[model samples]
Target chain A: MENEIAMEDKNSTFVVLPAYNEATRIRPVLEDIARKGYNMVLVNDGSSDNTLEVIKQVKKEFPDKIHIFSLLINRGVGIATQTGFEAVLKFNPKYIVSMDSDGQHSADDLDEVIKPLVTGEAQAVIGVRPFKDMPKSRSFANSIMNILTRIFYRVNVSDSQTGFRAITVEALDKISINATGYLISSEFIREINDNNIPFAEVPIQTIYTPETQAKGTNVKVAFKILLQMIKHQF
Target chain B: MYLYALIFPIISIIAIIWFITRYFKGKNSLITVVLWSIFWIIVSLFAIFPNVSSAFARLFGITRGLDFVIILVFVVLFYTVLKLYFIVDKMQNEINTLVKELALKNEISLDDEEE
Candidate 1:
């Protein structure tokens, strides 16, 4: 099922994976997306590890399909994803999907996430995860973000912090993200609301390993994100 | 006179001198130098004659000079902090833009080499 969708719109869709210090886990994620034949944009956020070397090695196998971008230093995930967007925009793709590199987001769900965009049902699509399936701490943090996003941006989504989402090129043009951290996810929802863009949410499987859970937003990061949102409001 | 009266005036004078030196070195504008000098001079006067603060406080309808001084300090600190916050935010945005552009430029050059 995923293969048919991938082969049909492979050239028009670009998958952007923003990775930071994912040297131990990035290869399989990249290979999975590559095997699906989607054009890949891998942004290395100045990983202190040998993540860049690993990306370069993977690029050797699919040199034509894989595009590698390296930040000079460790900018946060927000800017890293924005960099990927800028790089992929040059190629003029129809859809740009941003994913995490920690193997939390499944490559199999790529088709489902992009289905709304393909069918012209929505301009932007967020791959929502079942909160019940998430770890308690992460689930609690995500719930808080969801409520805050609704309050601040006046847009409600079950998951505002999910990296697994797809946006059409036209919709992407109307949105500008200035956040340089995890708060970028919230910024996306704000932009969508501000621009009056059509959006949808699809349920995606959540695979949380201990490493993945330990990496992304924790309680302290959530509090920081709340502060950033308030700052932007004023 | 109290010990703070002597110490504060001396500190204010030193600050005024430093501001003048910075102006002479072209690191500060004339307006900035004048404003800072006026501020420090006022500080020195308030420290030398604590009664003047009481008089000014009466003019502002405040009961105590100490209360007036505390309020003024807070206002100044708040303004300074807000100004610094905005400057830092602008710098962060500029740095992000520079870094993103550099990364994209390097990728374009690599593409050119491949072609």
Candidate 2:
């Protein structure tokens, strides 16, 4: 299923969802995004599960409302997202909002995230989640990442790990990343900060399920992120 | 160890030969070949005359020749690491492009089939 109207709308806002194994969880989220009439781009990162089928089913329902892309293999979240960004930029969209497909990000808060861009308040808007409500361990790691980013790169963002973000065409054009892993979050902040892009944040509710809460940033992943940051410095 | 000095010359000889052959075969750029050639020459020199590093070290007010060689090795490794990082970064970008194009083409072709 393909959406002919995917990029034709000059004034339309796009929501790009990079899916992994979100087969069951994202079915309803896709429905909600489609129900809201937002242009959708679903990127399946080579899920072994039935994610591709779920997206295929959703696309069949809203052929004119969404575009679905599945990578031939599993490239991590960063690579999938970069694919989505590159995919949407071809249409010359005015505003592009990216969210995770794991149902952590709300389709309803889509409006608020993109509002800053729509109103010309900020060229880039990050969907900041309340860390206090999160699990202690994951929240602490995220907070350390935020602090490290500010200390090392001189960029201040509340939620450095938040996947939900709204960026204008100009801001998206300035964003270039070389990470194939999770450090794309840090790369995004560095790109915006380096280019002096106007950045803003809006509070968004993060609905964490049991699975979401359990998927914490372990030591291995955290070390990789730190190594990527240090590697990128060179 | 004194034995490390001998190994450095052996490794340097191999590197020099490899780089020269690669340059002539058009596998490496002329600049890279020349740079590697100079680097190996310095390594072989220091390896053969361990006291040379000490003299050089004394000029910079350092203590021992082995310390000087170790410092040089660290610098070379650091430079190599940075260069390799850039190559890896470029490969990542290429992968992103390849994946993006493949996904888009697949989606478009499927849509065309439906039409």
Candidate 3:
């Protein structure tokens, strides 16, 4: 498996990291991924911190392996991720994987997440995190969102809100993302169902530092997502 | 006869005048000025003669003129809110597209510079 992955990592996979206000935590994540030899597309979502500087420094270190873009203003994660997808697609990679930049998604899981796409078993793969390992508030919100996604989109998945997922270039070409916020996760599932794309789910490690825990969706955001879902249904 | 009846018509007349002035100044569209002027005129007429509103309410199967007014206000408010939501949503999507395009263009220019 190691040899096979190493051979495939020769520019066949591009990892996308969409970041917002993650200046302090993004360096280690980027370095970890860079050390693994996979190409990266980093979208610095108009972060209010020095995240762009950090990204540029990292780009200098791995100039051949990284492509960076910065939105002039902070659009939400959805648009940022979509922009990353558009940027990476031009490179003609076999697969594209999107992961959070706050270090919640471990780089070690990158190979496992991309394996199904390589093996012809699935067109997309979702890196599922164990709810039992999450904080109570996040777990509760995730559970509710999971149920709502199942109900609204008719797609069943254990983790509907996971930021770590991989898609084939073929599947990526078939779908267009419209949501501009965190609700983009649900929109992905909707696109999968609508396009009849094959998908798989794999368990992945999630590291929840205080910073990561403090940056995700809250009750108000969840409510807005729900409203957006309803609006999309019609 | 009542103080409210006298005050409301005066306020409505002022609103009507303001709407017409805005239209003349090119700050408001013709449709907007017409609609607002009609609305204020109705309010003035309703305040001066409450019976007319009651008659209008009966046409809508509402029992009281005040209840009809409340319902009308809510419907208008809801319509305005929905319209504004769509406008903002469209503007946001456009901005996202513009920003994405610029970012992509920047990436291409950077690649050129590196070469």
Ranking by DockQ: 1, 3, 2
- Judging by TM-score against the true structure, name the best candidate: 1
TM-score of chain B of each: 0.82, 0.80, 0.71
Global local distance difference test of model 1: 0.88
lDDT of 2 by residue, A146-232 (tens): 887787678888988788888998888887866677787777888888998998989999887887765435456667788878876
The TM-scores, one per candidate, come to 0.91, 0.72, 0.89
Judged by whole-model lDDT over C-alpha atoms, candidate 3 comes out at: 0.88
Off by more than 4 A, model 1:
A6-8, B1-4, B24-26, B29-31, B108-115
In angstroms, the error of model 2 at A82 is: 1.4
By descending lDDT, how would the candidates be arranged?
A: 1, 3, 2
> Is candidate 1 or 2 superior in TM-score?
1
Lowest lDDT block of 10, candidate 3 chain A:
A1-10
i-RMSD values for every candidate model:
2.4, 2.4, 2.3
For residue A59, give model 1's deviation from the true position in Å. Answer: 1.2
